[model samples]
Target: MPYTRPARPPPEEASLQGSELAHEIVDVLVDRQAEDVVLLDMTSLSVFADYFVIATVDNPRQARAVVDAVEAHVLADGRSRPKVEGAADSSWILVDLGEGIFVHVFTEDSRAFYNLEGLWNRAQEVVRVQ
Candidate 1:
């Protein structure tokens, strides 16, 4: 079967209200075979995005694929194109999906080095996909 994008949200609706986009991102990452996906609720702890979705990939190639897939999904949802950081060769890539949602894609070694979950330990753990 041919792949298809999800329907765009209504034009009248201003934007994603809360953690709706974060949850959608969790599904996207999982679909692409991301491992140990963790969704953190940063609403009360941080002034940045309301939530953060972090996942680990196997390699740089997989990292690039995951980032591109996420970009496509976010654009298809009618949200502004995200501001992406880091190169495909980098160990970590950060995607800033506007409206207080940030995504961190990391390789196993990099994930361990950065320790985002520990740094943001105060944030609530919304979901964990093992």
Candidate 2:
């Protein structure tokens, strides 16, 4: 499929600054068997963040597990706890590790609705974890 550009650049480059931390979070998700892991590079666009790490879990249980793994890993790495949002319903969870790594954990329906991959068409795709 063709790529699509985000409506606006990320609010800051903070997300891109902590890429290693982001990668660690991705690794944790993968380890937990998260599905459809994807990394979006938003460096070229005018935005606040530099990168977006998106992934999917099969269900609410997995969604929560993914977030837990991310939190634990980031903390273990000695980074500040990420500012997380959207966990109440567990359909879509956003973990903000200020600088340039924004993580999104979404359910199938939510993932389809947000279509982040489609929205960030212009951003470079770093990887797609099957």
Q: Which candidate is the best by lDDT?
A: 1
Best by TM-score: 1
Model 2: how far is 31 from its true place, Å?
Answer: 0.5
TM-score of 1: 0.86
Candidate 2's C-alpha runs over 4 A off are 1-17
lDDT of 2 by residue, 13-129 (tens): 444445666676778889999888988777787467777889888888788888888888878877778898975567999988765678899998999999988888988988788
Candidate 2's TM-score reads: 0.82
Residue-level lDDT tens digits of model 1 in 41-95 = 9878887668899999999889899999999998998877999999979889999
Report how far residue 121 has shifted in candidate 1, in Å. Answer: 0.7
Clashing residue pairs for model 1: 49-100
Model 1 residue 21 CA deviation (Å) reads 0.6
Regions more than 4 Å wrong, model 1: 1-16
RMSD of 2: 9.8
